[model samples]
Target chain A: MVRPVNPPASWWRSGLAVLVVLGMLPVIGNIFRNDSSVSRCEWDGQVMRPEAAVTLELAGRSVTCCDVRCARNWLASHSERPTLIQVRDEHGGDPIDSADAFFVRSAVVTNRANGNRWHVFGDRETALRHARESRGRLMRGDEHPFAGVRGLE
Target chain B: MIVNAYAILSLFVCGLQCAVAVWLTGRWLNSRRAWSSGWTDDGAEVVERNAYLMMTLALVLLGLDLASWPLLYLLLQSYVPSWPGVMCIDGVTRIGTGSLGASRFLPGLLVTLQVFKPLVMLIGGAWLVIYLANRATSKAPLMRRLLWGLLLIGVTSLCDGVCTAGYLLIPKQEDHLAAGCCTQVTSTTTTRSSEPLLAGVSGTELTVVFMLLWAGLLFLLLDSIRKQRSGRKWMGGLLAITLVVAVLGGLFLVDVLSPALLQRPHHCPYDLVSELPESVIGIVLFMAGSFWVAAGAIASFCADVPETREILPGLQARVLFLGLFSYLGSFSLLSVQWCVL
Candidate 1:
């Protein structure tokens, strides 16, 4: 638990602090609604959940989505492909280059964009365990079915 | 996304929640001394004043915390064309997520808080409702319960502080560093190796569990009303079941119902509050029902106190009815949209 907010240093100190906070703020609408050019869930055209966003670098453009499923689906359907596919690692949650990642399809994990039904993992061991548990099929980034996309190579 | 517009205000909000937690805890500790002395009428008045201030401040903070979630998204968006290549909320969120290293998890935590913030609001709202229903009960277990609730928020607010700091640390997203959308972000990453454990539980299974859990909560609500026992047993049962229902129902929302509601295969609880039509109504009903049940139970816990006994039953019944109706009502409406209608 957080320690208590200490008593204000003094009345003027409190006022100064408030002013500083106010000065740093952007417009109020930006606080409540989005103004960025990237779409929330581009696949479904809905506001993306900050928790579930699946981001990929494709076709020299950014395709931000609701989940990995949509990103994967989009990559599969598109003629132009991503130069690099960086999927968020399930364990570390750091975005990993897709070529080095492992994937599982038809798992319980739901995407915010087009419920495409897939998850990405950084290691093969965990992905294999997930397949065993969730009845998912392994999607190896190194393999063709999953890696058919190549851009301007 | 461009430093969230609300980021600065969040510092104050988080500080207030921590302060309120501290104040309430101090009061709780002091109560032992106050009890031993017995409330001299003067002491009683002072305590009452402090209690009222703490609760009111806590509620005010909760209201603000709830509002800040969306603002976090917009703050990034406002950074916009200036950021170049960063077009949407996703671009704003993912850019840092990819480069922020260990702190990348902060954005995910902020989003998960979406499920929890409303619960804090419900707990606070329930306290307000119970306080309105009976003044006499405010002195007993109700105060202790209120302190615990605030403590929960205090702890969570600290997470907010971390996330806010992390957001600040993230440099402006470069044009070459953007990612896809939320679908890719939430599904692909396993923050902890343990995440795979959640797999295999299909959407259908989650839906069944969610409905069953809510049904159990409704049963508890009905029994509380039918017996009007107002004992610890009844109240504890009610509180416990409501908690499970909320937790399970929340998972279901993220995993199954959200997709069904949008008539697509997307899942994001925050979307329920977005531009979607009538989404807020469904969310409000769910919260109303859950909070009402909680409020009624808290009131019941204080029922045995002689001063509050007379008003307890009447208030409990009304509150329970509101909670049960709204909780089930949300499910019904979603069901109609998904299946029945």
Candidate 2:
């Protein structure tokens, strides 16, 4: 086999110079953007949890969370009281509006590594119906203290 | 014509891909000494990483190229008439007219072939590189990788380019008279006011020419390989014969197997056009160019070299010639289509 080229730092500097001479391509060009926004749940700017009710708000936009872990982390850190409303979907683990939530009773809570609880509704029929019918997550009124709690009112 | 949104998007994607490749290559080069045995043969994994990165980047660009078909379909629906027989599928819906979609065995098969076309060149490049690398490690070096690579690129590029042209010219639909025969020959004198001398220049003819040119290129490639290996002349000869026969068989099969493919083209004007003189010139230019490429490929293959002389570069040159000719030939066939239909 042939010995690969192991050029010195000056070679890299020259390569960079050549690149600069060719012009900063990607940096100078417009990038392609897809129309449909399909961000992953874990990667999205939403918190995941089950017991505590907390809303995630960004500027004028707001979404709801189901757990205390979600409520604590999702709210604005600088403010004493969150001015925005947001909540997580109890069943699907997605963030949705707490006002429009439909929390189901007899929900099973699963433990997390971060001491957070993830609730799975015990009623398969209700969960299936909600999954099929609802566009977003549904949380019941008695699921958490902040389920019916008013924020930015 | 102005570049459409999709084309622009493709260009952007291509640029991004190239940028990512350059960046990734730079990073690999920097971290070469630290690479472990899982990735590279030695501590230096930069070259192997660069090759993979380059291939990935090229594949992405090719995807962008294939995406052009869907965008063109959309354009046809929105801007052009349906023309009744042709099928149209928007980006969301899957459309297949008997055998157009990926689900259908044939059209999907063709599309798949197209996707891997770049790899053919890339593989050849890798082979030449490896060959040179092995030789370089020897007590007496036989060939230089860069030289062989450049030569192959030059030759194969020519052949592939011509093949591409021929492919474009030859209508995908097996039938030549898809639009039906000329009902009226307009008596308008354009640039070239010559009588219809070329009668049998159908889509099938273009397809045959394409297949033949492709075969010739492949034959030359085999010849190059034969020169490298011992006792390979018989195998090379067999391949050459098979390729030629297959091309001929394809031409014959186009008419027999798919008779209903081409109905008589409607509004086909076999007119005395003075304006179409340039078209005749265009055909001549195409044929001449194809001939030149074929000649070069053949000549390169037959050229005798000393056992000590570097021959891979010469082989590479032949491949480039074949590529150029193939593309040019396809274009000519397309021009002929424009003339007839």
Candidate 3:
């Protein structure tokens, strides 16, 4: 029977270096890839669309949510209330303070999986128009969508 | 039952493994009986034939088993499109859960098989290393022990076959069940269950600990390579410590590194794999490194046997070096990700 011979130490070292370099190739490519423009919701890690984006300050950091329902759900789960809450106006697509915005629970669902139905608008007329068109109800700015719902509160 | 080319191939490989395992088991028993009866040199040729046949079939089964690990994921990924709301492999895993009128057996078996596949591969790889070392000897002194090892591998492969077949063959309902994906189920926050293990350690701190452990393991492996005879003394201890480090490494990866890699606060390993496909290289390197370390340790233990002592040291050195290379490669790749990201 022939004995198996071990390769030279230098050979092993060279192989190691080559393998390490090969392993880093993809990582190097990743560094150059532009993924910064894509924004994902903080709550569910879903990609956030510009039109339906909601922003809230949690723990001194701005957290983006996909819609009003996610933002509310996030706030309800955390012990500390958000210092600032902002939602994008559906008509103009500009961020507006949640307090100044009119929320319409439209029949049109924004996010089906999370059951998001409320649409935020800077103008009451647009909110009423959306409510009428979609057969939705206007919710007060201070109203909690999940309030009194079991386990959500 | 998402029938696709990958699923068909997996089932075929699994079936072949099952058939080979049964054949090998029968051969092993016959050989054991022959050895027990103390047949003289007249039966040496028969024994040699049996050993050759069994070893050949076992190696093939081992290759098939190793291939099945990757194939399992491919099969799952293929099923993703068929299942609504199933965006990732995690969703495909839930298919068994939502199957109409199906017992919990299918999902439970899938999980069990997932856990077992790696273990089977590790053990089988270690056995292959030992067999090679033994084969280098003129006398083939480790034949009896190798036979027992083969039997153990055969049993595992048989079980793997059964589990894979059950998972693949069991029909799943086409009804689209609203199964929660990894994003919904994987908790971003640290939970009570992990609190004790973490002991309030932050992700950065845990990463630091993990790096330090890897550094220590690499040093030990280097020392073992330099001093082969002395290395035998701590082989068992090294094995135990390595096992602990592996567990800690896995925890660090899933909880800390995965989120960091994916740039998501609430990311799971599935997300990391899906988003950063390159990270799979890091995972594979780490797993391969861990397996080499374990196999080296097992070989060292086997070297305690008088007949196999001569060739085991060289085999152990080579295996330990491989482990070092793999661990270093994985660490370097992860560091690059950490630094760049």
TM per prediction: 0.53, 0.24, 0.81
Against the true structure, what is model 1's DockQ? 0.04
Better of 2 and 3 by TM-score: 3
lDDT of 1 by residue, B230-327 (tens): 67677878888887887777777777766565444445544444434344455667877777787777666543456667667756766776676676
Candidate 1 residue spans exceeding 4 A from truth: A1-153, B4-49, B69-102, B108-119, B133-198, B219-223, B226-229, B270-277, B302-304, B339-341
Q: What lDDT would each prediction earn against the true structure?
A: 0.58, 0.37, 0.74
Clashes of each: 50, 68, 0
Model 3: how many Å of interface RMSD?
Answer: 4.2
What candidate 2 gets wrong by more than 4 Å, as runs, is A1-153, B1-52, B55-231, B242-259, B262-341
Clashing pairs in 3: none
Over B26-127, each residue of candidate 2 has an lDDT whose tens digit, in order, gives 544444444434445553345444444543543443344344333333332332122222212211111122433232332443344344344333434344
What DockQ does candidate 2 have relative to the true complex? 0.01
User: What is the lDDT, from 0 to 100, of the residue A3 in candidate 3?
Assistant: 35
What tens digits encode model 3's per-residue C-alpha lDDT throughout B1-341? Answer: 66889989999999998999999899888787777778667466567779999999889888888888878877876775664455456656665453445533666887888888988878887887789778788777778778888898889999999999988887765333454763223321111121224547788888788878878888988877766532555888778878978998888877787767765444356655556666777788888888988988887766446666776787787887788788877877777877766
Residue A77, candidate 2: C-alpha displacement in angstroms: 82
